[model samples]
Target: MWVNLGVILLQFLSGSIMYSYIIARILKVDLSKIRDGNPGASNLWRAVGWKYGILALFLDYLKGALPLAIFVSLGIVKDNFVISLAALSGVLGHAFSPILRFKGGKAVAVSFGAWSVLTKWEAPMLLGTIFTIFTIIKPKGTTVQEDAFRVILGYLFLLPYIIYKSFHGDFHLLIFYDGNFAVILYKHYKDLWGYLRGQS
Candidate 1:
């Protein structure tokens, strides 16, 4: 019981750290007044450059992946449930990082990292489709609203797969697995609502 509690606590702690903000600060960028008003890699990409964006993305991804790697290596979380929970911490971290006063990114990249470890090849397939769709549809300098649409379309593409896999297989391994994506969707709900209102 104590071991499980420890794992959960560590997950929360790991997920709460805001690495992107830290990177931004190191780069001498004030991320609180940027595009989307976020300290995420995307904002950092625009603030600094693509090189910084790539580096931030890598560090953000590694933060999640490294913790899961540690849990798997230490054998502290052998069950899929525990693994999923720990991985979700990274996504949650990206979404509501304590370092950023609980205001963080939309959790897309962190979730993608976690899914990559759990779902293997299918993970890249999902992420690639999202990237390709955005690249094709997004304008050269897309607004926040435009980016949100890309995100929604990316998620919509995976809806069928999520429903199919959850109902068709031993999906207990996916309890908090999809939570990462859901968190992102929840974060961007406001943008979605605006889009709906405009359509009507």
Candidate 2:
């Protein structure tokens, strides 16, 4: 139990590093004053440039991937509950990083990395395909918020597919995916609400 706790704490710390914020600081760009006021790679791209943005994205992905990979490789927490907890800690930390005063990225990239490890890339590939199709269909000049909403909608569409695939077994995986979807929706509640209200 203590080992599980330590693993979770370590994963959270890794996620809380706020790679975008660090990159923005080094580039002398205040992410808070940038697009959507998000201290994330997307905002960093808008604030500074794509180079820094890509770097931040990679770092965020690593934060999620590395710790979980290490824990699994070390056989620290073999049970599904503890393993899921470790994965969730990274995402929660990224979404609500302590270094950024408990405000952080949307966890899109970080979640991708973590889920890739957990699901052996099946989930990410499916989601990425959906996201790509949506991106292609999105009207030009769409606002960032709108694009994000479209992505979430895509994920919503994925739920049925996930359920269909797991009909034979793996009920725990359904719960895991649902929990992730819930976290994402909750994190983007403000944006989603504003979009619904036609308030930019």
* Per-candidate total of colliding backbone pairs: 1, 0
Give candidate 1 regions above 4 Å deviation. 198-200
Q: What alpha-carbon RMSD in Å does predicted model 2 have with respect to the real structure?
A: 2.0
lDDT by residue (1-200, candidate 2, tens digit) is 89889988888898888989888888788888986788888888878778888988889888977787887888767876676777778888898899988877888888887776677778788888877876677745456667567668767876876687569565556766776777788778788777777875
Poorest lDDT segment (10 consecutive residues) of candidate 2: 139-148
RMSD of each: 2.6, 2.0
Off by over 4 Å in 2: 139-141, 164-169, 198-200
TM-score of each: 0.86, 0.89
| TM accuracy, model 2 | 0.89
Evaluate model 1: give its lDDT. Answer: 0.72
Question: Would you list the clashing residue pairs of candidate 2?
Answer: none
Give candidate 2's error at residue 61 in angstroms: 1.5
